[model samples]
Target: MTSIKIDRSACQGYGNCVLALASVFDVDGEGLVVLRRDTVEPGELDGLRRAAYDCPTDSITFVA
Candidate 1:
């Protein structure tokens, strides 16, 4: 399974990840991006990667 990790300290609440992969990520009421699903579904790998890469602070990490 692919695992997703986010560094809250480095996150700027840009919501890029949420917009890129709503299934695995979302912006909470505070506007901070949250990982709704830590493990990526098989078909969602691409979107997850895109979200991680799109993060301006590079706060997202993927582990296989």
Candidate 2:
């Protein structure tokens, strides 16, 4: 399965990733990006890519 990775140190927590894909990304109470799940479903690949692309800090990446 393809999975996602995030660099916590590089994440700016702009919430764009979350906005782009709520099922895959979330914002914690402290305003940080949280990965709800690492693995991606084939149907959700577009959403995953959108989330990664929308990340303001470019902190999200795919590990296929």
Candidate 3:
């Protein structure tokens, strides 16, 4: 199983991750990243990785 993590302190609210994978990520009212889930589905891994890379603050990370 893969696990997704977001460093809230490091998040810049850029919304790149949310754009990349809205099902897995979203922006709260304050515009910070809100993780929809921690465990990544097998099919979502690629998109999740892309989201992680797209984050300007490098707040997204994963354990596979």
Which prediction has the highest TM-score against the true structure? 3
What lDDT does candidate 3 reach at residue 30?
Answer: 89
lDDT value for candidate 3?
Answer: 0.92
lDDT of 2 by residue, 2-63 (tens): 88998888887799987888988888887888889989888888888888887778899997
lDDT of 3 by residue, 14-35 (tens): 9999889999999999899998
User: Model 2, poorest ten-residue lDDT window?
Assistant: 47-56
TM-scores for all candidates?
0.91, 0.89, 0.95
Residue 55 alpha-carbon offset, candidate 2, angstroms: 1.1
Model 1 stretches with alpha carbons more than 4 Å out: none
Clashing pairs in 2: none
Badly placed stretches (over 4 Å) of model 2 are none
- lDDT of all predictions: 0.88, 0.86, 0.92
Query: Among all windows of ten consecutive residues in candidate 1, which has the lowest summed lDDT?
Result: 26-35
- Candidate achieving higher lDDT, 1 or 2: 1
Candidate 1 colliding pairs: none
- Write candidate 1's Cα lDDT for 1-64 as tens digits: 8998988888889999988999888887778888887898778899988998899999999987
Q: Which stretches of candidate 3 lie over 4 Å from their true place?
A: none
Cα error, candidate 1, residue 57 (Å):
0.3
